[model samples]
Target: MDMMVSSLQQQRAITDQLRREAGIKRIPVSQAVEDIIKYITEHEQEDCLLVGFSSQKVNPFREKSSCAVL
Candidate 1:
């Protein structure tokens, strides 16, 4: 268990370094959820416009995979 935790910490350090080098933004999940909820509430989707969503079976954490909410 100690080895696993240490390995995870090392991996996290590498990930943080890579993200810093790439200039990526990391949004807190709570903040993102709050923003999404606020947007939906303020927009009040009463117009009943075309709402579309699609997703594929893939590891969302993969750098090559993507998702959009619009």
Candidate 2:
């Protein structure tokens, strides 16, 4: 019982540390979906390219990137 709880806490701590190290921001699934839907709705009339970044360093939208889009 106590051991199980301790293990879960340790796992959560490790997950959080990894996310921090990787610059990953955690968002709720519903919020992410809603944001995507909103973006699509706003741009439905325009030709859109959904660019994806596998890592933050390559993302142009990130302010920290050297080639960030202004």
TM-score of each: 0.35, 0.36
* Superposition error at 58 for model 2 (Å): 29
The TM-score obtained by model 1 is: 0.35
Q: What is the lDDT of residue 17 in candidate 2?
A: 93
lDDT of 2 by residue, 35-69 (tens): 99999888866632454566777666677636766
Best by TM-score: 2
Q: For residues 1-70, what per-residue lDDT tens digits would candidate 1 score against the true structure? A: 9999999999999999998988976789999999999988877654233332233333343466377778
C-alpha positional error of residue 28 in candidate 1 after TM-score superposition, expressed in Å: 0.5
The window of 10 residues in a row where model 2 has the poorest summed lDDT is 45-54
What overall lDDT goes with each candidate model? Answer: 0.73, 0.80
TM-score of 2: 0.36
